[model samples]
Target: MARLTKKQKEALAKIEKGKLYSVDEASALIKDVTNTKFDSSVDIAVRLGVDPRKANQMVRGVVSLPHGTGKDMKVLALVTPDKEAEAKEAGADYVGLDEYLDKIKSGWTDVDVIITMPSVMGKLGPLGRVLGPRGLMPNPKTGTVTMDVAKAVTEVKAGKIDFKVDKTGIVHAAIGKASFSADKIAGNANELLTTLIKLKPTTAKGVYVKSIFMSSTMSPSIAVDPKIG
Candidate 1:
């Protein structure tokens, strides 16, 4: 309820500039400051000033979070006939035959998250053209297209936030609300950071992490000079 005084603001800026926060520390700090169940690591990544929209900065590879991301992501599973039950048990909103090719043509625009096996991707070229623009295309490079249906759906539903690199190579994503505990964001951030560090492409030149920042939906960006670069 109180604003950060000059001294407090200065200290925060200093710590932020250092940009080293563990999951526990971030969660504890946020917990003491606010009461909200929105545990999003995206917020922490944003606090570090990591943009989520850059194509160069993207969510690729297998990033298994210790705690699933907290969100109600509508899931659509595309699988063969036999896998219908498996998809349903995974809690996918919609499970279907491999003919999802026609399905996406008819209702792809409305879906939030999509999971598909290699069998499905065979017919995905045109679909990619359609969904890529909408940011809904399932690219294996981004770990969206996988043979594991349940795992994909579970991660997506659990807030497995994906970061993508745009023309500028920067990405943007949501971690949680401003009221969320810093610890949640920190954990999410740690998971994300670890993934990125591990997946730095061979083509990527010097310093994968550029700069990071965090901010609430209504707050200003808290620039984080993590010195990872």
Candidate 2:
């Protein structure tokens, strides 16, 4: 139920599928076909021929969301004796206090998210190479290292989405599923768009939030109207 203007339709048709581009690449494509400024949500949406809200999150660190990410995150928690039972009761996928430090070398790959207590930081330091690249390392700054087990697990399940501004300062995140009510997706999209816009880096140039695409897992995106909320 979204309508595209003639110019917008042309821009959308120009972009090749599955070809991700940097901001400059994106801008050049628009200028080549249409001389309009590639600086607004509408412009970016038209260029991609898809909703900007459909883009998956580009998060750098992990956090626990109050409502969870809506995806089942296999969580591995590192806790001491005092907090061991609390972790299991909170639905942690794997809970322990370093009794299985050796196991951390193996099953971590099978898990989606990893949570570690402050005390275990010393031991986990060695895993910087193994888990860091996968974005699984627990760090306090990113809110991955936490003492609260229940809060962490609950948020992971709800959709503790994470995102980082790309080199171009564009923050991307999936707003919702295509079958979701437009209003619902719109609300979520607005929330994320607003947050990223507000969190723009002082050093970054040009527009902040950039393009948004909302689409199903395998379907094309439907551009959502980006409103300043």
Candidate 3:
């Protein structure tokens, strides 16, 4: 195993061994442990007591952070001619149909969130090979694929994010930035946790939220007590 750096060792020292902290405590501690020069993203990893492989047990949903994600989300609005103005007015970074589609076909996925209409989804089906793997594909469930292009684009710009449980039953998401106040970080984390609780599948038995960890881009994770939510 690689030896820990001086900074890494120092970071670990700040966290008590085997101690599970409350949401507020973990949020503040994460900022204290972050050693990155740039503003690092504060992420939350939630381990759920469910099997993702089972269709009925899958957990996926969207949440709008109360304090908003610190980073500006680059949104692409792929819409027909009539809806272009609406999309642009809603603060979409990029707006268009054929040209954007051609760019996507050419392996140009430079944007974060892609919001498009149901009619446009048919054209996007062929480009799934490029978008699917990157998790940029617009899905109806996430409200990314909808006729209300303006609403979708606005929501995404206003800190809306979608997350799905991984194969290992962990849902990982960047809740905010380390530069944000501890209260802001904790607020975002709580919002996400509450949403996840509401989305628990009926088939999921026992402890829905098994564990939660909060950390920055390169900081040691702080264990968050699941019961605190």
The best candidate by TM-score is 3
Per-residue lDDT of 97 in model 2: 53
Q: Which lDDT tens digits does candidate 2 get at residues 119-219?
A: 88899888778887776777775566788877776676566756654444344554433333334444554455555555444544444344554433323
Candidate 3, lDDT over the whole model: 0.94
Q: lDDT of model 3 at residue 129?
A: 96
Q: After superposition, how far is residue 182 of candidate 3 from its true place, in Å?
A: 0.4
Clashes (backbone N, CA, C under 3 Å), per candidate, total 40, 18, 0
Candidate 1 residue-wise lDDT, 85-144, digit = tens: 888998899888545678677755677777777877777776776787878767676567
Off by over 4 Å in 1: 1-59, 98-100
RMSD, one per candidate, in order? 5.8, 11.2, 0.9
RMSD of 3: 0.9
Where is the poorest 10-residue window by lDDT in model 3?
Answer: 220-229
Candidate 1 positional error at 96, Å = 1.2
Worst 10 residues of 2 by lDDT: 41-50
- Write model 3 residue lDDT over 1-229, tens digit each, in one string: 9899999999999999999999999989998999999999999999999999999999999999989899889999999999999999999999999999999999899999999998889999999999999999999999999998899988888899999999999999999999999999999999999999999999999988999998899898898898854
> lDDT for every model?
0.60, 0.54, 0.94
- Candidates in order, TM-scores: namely 0.69, 0.63, 0.98
TM-score between model 2 and native: 0.63
